[model samples]
Target: MDHDHVRDVDPAVADALEGELERQRSTLQMIASENHVSRAVVDAQGSVLTNKYAEGYPGSRYYGGCEYADEVEQLAIDRAAELFGAEHVNVQPHSGTQANQAVYFAMLEPGDRILSLDLTHGGHLSHGHPANFVGQLYEVEQYEVDAETGYIDYDGLEEQAAEFDPDIVVSGYSAYPRDIDWERIQDVADDVDALHLADIAHITGLVAAGVHSSPVGIADFVTGSTHKTIRAGRGGIVMCDEEYADDVDAAVFPGGQGGPLMHNVAGKAVGFEEALQPEFEEYAEQTVANAKALGETLADEGFSLVSGGTDNHLVLVDLRESHPDTSGGDAEVALEEAGIVLNGNTVPGETRSAFDPSGIRAGTPALTTRGFDEDDCRKVGELIARVIDAPDDEAVKAEVREEVEALCAANPLYEDD
Candidate 1:
């Protein structure tokens, strides 16, 4: 899309928009929580629906002229319900964090206890980090991953739950590489007579496409970001049984967010339609396969991987053992300079601070979207090893950057534009 109207109205904003588009076209987005949505999704998000102020659910809006808005929101909800086998789905959450907030607002009282995974152990900030509102408003306790195994310590979590008697148990993660056992976590919550909120923000698409186990029926509440693995634009969704439908809807609307982002809801409808296609399953499967290949390549090069590998679209590499001199931030900067874009992440038993942690998390969702296969990801892994092995070497960075350009060309993104 040329966005000629935008250029005519505002030159500076137009240039920035064009620059952002070019950046996406050229860079490899390896952030586990990020993905490349289809062109249709982008168009839908940029549509006229943004002008509407649909402050409530479909067929019942707080504003007028919502017929089209109702249509779009209903379609999004229907598609998501089908995709997840959820008894009820709320597509109005502004983000995954808001989705979590909806659950909290619906069920928990002020100062209620929350048991969640630690941020440094692959948990999200919304899951009771001190910097967030939930931490201040609620009593929070955190569990850790098994430092030696790089997996969730289920036994430890259960013990903690027993001791703490939390009001709710939060599962799912941001940087975790292993597949989550929803049933295990649910059992713990059950034993404690607590609720379970599984935030599958990072694996929404994998769950929908059956590439990973779903937490829909297993957990009491499930939440996710529509833009991440789901490729359904930038928003949040909540799923639960019919009994919690009204409560979830109320919590998401007047309780947490005001007017829904109707344009993004349109984008969700379009993207969810695309996800239902047979090819999406293949894309989801290939994403996991590519991650495995990338992790295997890095492991072969003597890089230490959390959990020793991945069963999903991402892998977390602990740099402390493999590259003691380099921090995750250092490797991340050097890698970005060499044209590979991912994040510096915290690992279990982290020694450094979160801002400059000791781990790097890489995912294959965007690469696979660009038509990259396992072989291509292996090559990418080799480049990563080289750059991290000698982050200060200009010659190596230049060489790798050239290769990155070639790879981008071969697996072209937005080529028509």
Candidate 2:
């Protein structure tokens, strides 16, 4: 983490890199889509593989001198298949969005219909948001979570599918806390004779550890980011049965991207190896436990938790009901000032703009990676409530900052650095 060579070349960039490392070490990283990767993964990501260009899958590349590249990419593909129990795997997409793009390009035509969850109700932009290419390229329809229960309205989704008759039905979510019924979504897709794409970008590690229900065999295509819960550096993966393997591979390579990020593929290989260890399962279980503890503590402090709690790694807090005056953006800024890092998120039935939504989303993956337990998460929740309760109070923020420093000291991150 010293960045000695970087300092010798460019002192300013070196300072920023060192500062980022220190920031992660000092603050509470509770962002749901973020996690801390092991040093081995970091080293692999910074490896000399970055200098190489592997244009195609293993043993079938268009370029020469791809011997080592073939080996590393095949290792990543094999490990990901073992972890997810998929017949075929592609580890080339630069991100989860690109992974989704591959699936769309492989199976969809221009003007084909796509039905997915709404962005404000726990969906992703790649699913069908007008701002993204997917929305622009396809005829898109959206479904929502039940207003009363704060859960996906499966029945409503079924009806929407019947009317929209989509070519593909996208499942999985971003901010929703409850476990998804993949079979139910698959049934809807089946009835419509449509393909199902399950994006588990937020819970790849949890699924790998058998802590979350997998959609590998059930959905037509399963896609995810290698980071997030997996801590597998930074990349995206797509898994499907062998029948669609060639289509997915070609779509990922020639259709969406050219040369894969070889260094990131190396990182994924290392991180996947690390995740196969028994301890990673414990880490996954503890991450969910910590999220539950955090939600309970926040609920006790009078913060309204969406869906009443969480089933995975994150808890979504709707601030409009409890703290009518404080916006999620307001709480986000104040919490950052107090060294607690999380995001202001849009709730199910969002009343405010996405920029300053009514909710805050927090998770426990990074904290659990740093050896935090349920009790530690509860204390962190209390600190969050305090900051949210009096966002404008400098004295309260100062006190919470001190407590945050103590927590960081107790549960050190990147200590070896």
Candidate 3:
């Protein structure tokens, strides 16, 4: 964690980088699927392995002299498999979307019926949004959450599955704030003879740390981002039972993507090992606790949290209900001006576009990594409240900025590692 011992980075770049660190320390990071990687993981990502362009799988590389890279890559693949109890893992996909694509290519034929969570409700773009090829190439059916509770009604999902009788069922979300019923999806899959894919991209790290229930043992397919909750670099991973091992591998290699990111693969390996550590579990637990605290504080401040509150890292704060003047886009800019970082997102029934969503999607995983606790979360909620309640008031924004600076001065990002 000490900068004095670190030698690889340039002094000027390091100074510039330190400013970003100061920004992180000063502001709160609430992006649901973001986290700070450990020093070890960062080192692994920056290792000499980046020099190689080793294409193809370990023992079967197109280029020679990939023996060592092969070992590092295999370490990631095998360890990831162990960590998630996955019979097979392809740690090669460029991201969670790419990982999802692999599965779709492997299983569903063009025009095959595929059921997924409706995007506006709680789904990723890769989950067959009409604009995406999945919808154009495949017959896609969407299921929505309950109109009242903002939770997915298992009955409604089943009814859709029965009606569609699709070839694959996607169960996951990007903005959703509760745990999913993987077993129930599996049951529905059985009823429809569909392949069930659970994209736990947001909760993958929590699941790995045992702080959250995982879809590994229950679902036929699992896809995730190594960066999000796992806190590695930008990349994706796919895992499945032995039954789909060969198909998944072939789909990822020849089906979805071309060359593998060997350096990032090495990085994923490091992160997977880090997740196996004991303290990582503690970090995940605190991440959720901080999220709950932030959610409670926000609610207490008169904001309406979608699903009433969060059971995970992120919360969908429907600002329309409280601060009708501020759209998600307005709040996003307002908060950014006050030194806070978060994304504007669509709510369950969001009428706004993604560029100007109706809700602000906030979470605590990244802030908790900076050693923030519940008290910090509450103060962050207050800071966010000020910005949302008075988006145009420069004085309020300045005051919130000062409070954020004080909070950052206390935490001091990347100082503890």
Which stretch of 10 consecutive residues in model 3 shows the poorest summed lDDT? 1-10
Sort the predicted structures by lDDT, highest score first: 2, 1, 3
Model 1 stretches astray by more than 4 angstroms:
none
Residue lDDT tens for model 1, 1-417: 586899999999999999988777787889888898988999999999989998887878888999999999999999999999999999988899999999999999999999999999999999999999889889999999999999998999999999999999999999999999999999999999999999999999999999999999999999999988889899999999999989998998899989998899999999999999999999999999999999999999999999999999999999998899999999999999999999999999999999999999999999999999999999999999999999999999999999998899999887788
Question: How far out, in Å, is residue 219 in model 1?
Answer: 0.5
Question: Per-residue alpha-carbon lDDT of model 2 for 92-195, expressed as tens digits?
Answer: 99999999999999999999999999999889999999999999999999999996688898899999999999999999888889989999999999999999
lDDT over C-alpha atoms for residue 150 of model 2: 88
Q: In model 2, what is the error at residue 47, expressed in angstroms?
A: 0.2
Q: What's the C-alpha lDDT at position 88 in model 2? A: 95
Q: Summarize candidate 3's per-residue lDDT along 1-417 as a digit string, tens digits.
A: 434434365676667666766666677777787777877777788778888877788899889999998999899988888788888888999999999999999988898988999887879899999888787889888999885798999998898899889999999789888888889999999998898999999998888888778899799999999998787777999999888988998998878877787778888998888888888899889888988999999999999988898888888898787987789999999999998999988888787887898899998888888888999999999899989988999999999999888887787766755
Error of 3 at 139 (Å): 1.6
TM-score of each: 0.99, 0.99, 0.94
TM-score of 1: 0.99
The list of candidate 3 runs beyond 4 A from truth reads: 1-22
Top lDDT hit: 2
Clashes of 3: 2
Candidate 1 residue 125 Cα shift, in angstroms, is 0.5
Q: How accurate is candidate 2 locally (lDDT)?
A: 0.95
